[model samples]
Target: AQRVTQPEKLLSVFKGAPVELKCNYSYSGSPELFWYVQYSRQRLQLLLRHISRESIKGFTADLNKGETSFHLKKPFAQEEDSAMYYCAPPFYGGATNKLIFGTGTLLAVQP
Candidate 1:
């Protein structure tokens, strides 16, 4: 089945360090990628989506179809950025659209 992969389970970095959250996907059609984030005790919410080509909270992800990847990146890390980050693609199942999310990578920003 088509899926998204987040290779790292935990990514720890000191404040001001550059951060990258890896995400790779496999799909047959033109895919829509999303980065979802869950802060501590908070619900998962959309961080960014590929089609809009937008950046959220100083983070950006570019779709590279040739590489089948949409890796999330930031120029620097901050304590507030600590959270669980998921890579996802919309799954068209029957009449409904569902999201298939990666196992998620926890970003820990150490001060």
Candidate 2:
């Protein structure tokens, strides 16, 4: 079974401060990790993927295979950056492009 874990349910940070959201996973096979974000009243969108090595909205996440982790980080936080973040891994069954998400972390950036 593949599992993604986001230990923090809520995180608050002041504007301009750096932020890091912790994530861990347990999977026997090679994992495909992704970060998904949902803004207020908006649909969830892909933030980044381990395979892409791309950064979005000043946020970046690196998949650490050794640690079984993919922690998201940003050097500076903005009020606009506040959102619900989820760590997701592909479903084990290999059915379509579906993803199983971890309990998300709600990020609140105080102005």
Q: Specify the highest-TM-score model's number.
A: 1
Against the correct fold, how does model 2 do in TM-score?
Answer: 0.94
lDDT of 1 by residue, 6-101 (tens): 999999999999999999998998999999999999999999999998889999999999999999999999999999999989988899879999
**Winning candidate number (lDDT):** 1
TM-score list, all predictions: 0.97, 0.94
User: Model 1 — which ten-residue stretch has the worst lDDT?
Assistant: 88-97
Which residues of candidate 2, in runs, are more than 4 Å off?
92-95
Per-candidate Cα lDDT values, in order, are: 0.96, 0.92
Model 2 Cα lDDT, one tens digit per residue, 1-111: 667899999999999999999999998777888999999999999899988888888899988889999999999999999999999987655657679899999999999
lDDT score for candidate 2 against the true structure: 0.92
